[model samples]
Target: MAKRALSVLVSGYTFLEGLRWHEDRLWASDFYTGKVIAAGLDGRVTEMAQVPQQPSGLGWLPDGRLLISSMRDRKVLRREPDGTLAVHADLTALTGGHINDMVVDRAGRAYVGNFGFDLMSGAPFRTTGLVCVEPDGAARVVAEGLWFPNGSFITPDGRTLIVNETFGNRVSAFDILPGGNLGPRRDWASFGAMPDSDDIGTLMAAASIAPDGGALDAEGAVWVADAIGKRIVRVQQGGRILEQIDTGEQGIFAAALGGPRGTTLFMAAAPNFAEHERRATRLGQILMAEVDVPHAGLP
Candidate 1:
């Protein structure tokens, strides 16, 4: 396979995640910087919102409002039409650990995921639940016992939702019920079998694939960032690798499809995902690579 070159669009960030292409700009959340930013293709950057609790995932509701995942505080933020950032839903009492990523459906329902265990504290592995925050701010556990549900996307038809189970080394799919609840799940792709131990260190070492954030293309294929492999791969149904881009030294945390004609693939690359290392140095970058398939799905 011929490794393609990546062009750096922007740098000098602590860590970038939760990328989305909307309103002719690439929107992202910087973890350590505690801000949500939008960047143009010309490398110009604009600070959109300041999240003191740290923002992770980014999405938009049907009414054109922005919903952000406040990671540490376990809340979902909403940018009102008047430009005020307020708590739309609080999950501090609902979730076990930090909130990470989310995808908002057409009906304005936000599906959110959490860390499940304290990664900073080095706690043992504990499965967590995926909750759906309704437009009215009501939340409920939709699914439980997920091994670290990270990046997620809803299919274009609005019927299926796919989420990256990082530690589980697989991607899971669920049917989006009419009332915003998730149906029984099926393994979309499994890179390797899961181990028996419920330890973070053991699971991390035993897994063969660490699928992180992902983006959906027009053809229903997903481009997923492999945290452990330090690369991005375009995968079809049943785990067929179509194309891959080796990120070289940088470990890609997230990926998004954007740019003119939706042919550009944006990657959130950094040395590592550790909070201490990422905050100590501003080495995070948004790298771009042109691909054949155009984007055609929700955030």
Candidate 2:
């Protein structure tokens, strides 16, 4: 059964990802356009910054400067108060693949993830590490051996970090130590055992859900965009689906709960995930729905 139909909040984007609700607006990165934008419910859109190599994830520092993931260049760019972009953290030597999504705590500690392997080139799957960039701009690997870590969230108390392992068929969690280092990992939500195949097609087929970008609700539940299921689903801690919104033809890549009342659920959708295919058209859209719970946790 469907909870509700998704209405188009905004459309004509190349491909939207890493969306967040901040300061009464929706912020996101357009992969192909290389532009990080912010949109309001009134249909107004603003360009925040541009990353030449491309932008995927977004966050904010304690001083209010914006941080964006420069995917291809393997770097995190910071937008200064003057609106100029500068290098905040150089991850070229710390990561193996193109940098992907990121989550930043109140103290400005950023945990960024990567692809682990080349999917566009059809390369075999490889495990990767998660890099934690400190408030001083220093970076190091806090955890490793992850299978395509994507969306992430820091508990309001800043004690636990939960990350979705897209190809692992589970959401892994860790304790956020005093210095931002992570403790041993545990399965916060497991759809099934981790897939053992190296082929992307085989792994996708064996998994129950490929969780992508997501948002945490005030009730401690997460709304995850199911890349394999082509829908938006609310997930509990133990892999239970609390609510689901089916998208007949659109493929969702990101989710966010925002708006005046904080009940508006925003979803980023497209026809497909093919980079080349999306670059040729602006069919990507931001879909909106309503939920009972408001948002909580860090970006």
Candidate 1 residues lying further than 4 Å off, grouped into runs, are none
Candidate 1 local Cα displacement, residue 192, angstroms:
1.3
Q: lDDT tens digits, residues 20-109, model 1?
A: 999999999999889899999999999999999999998988889999999999999999988789899999887999999999988999
Shift of residue 72 alpha carbon in model 2, Å: 0.3
lDDT by residue for model 2 over 1-299, one digit each (tens)?
54685688789999999998889899999999998999999869999998889899899999998999999999999999999999999998999899999999999989999997888888999989899998778999999988899999998888999998888888899999988999998989999975578899999999889999999988889998988888988999998999888898898998888899888999999988888899999999999998889988887
What overall lDDT goes with each candidate model? 0.91, 0.90
Cα RMSD (angstroms) for every candidate in the order listed: 1.0, 1.0
Off by over 4 Å in 2: none
Question: How far is 160's C-alpha from truth in model 1 (Å)?
Answer: 0.2
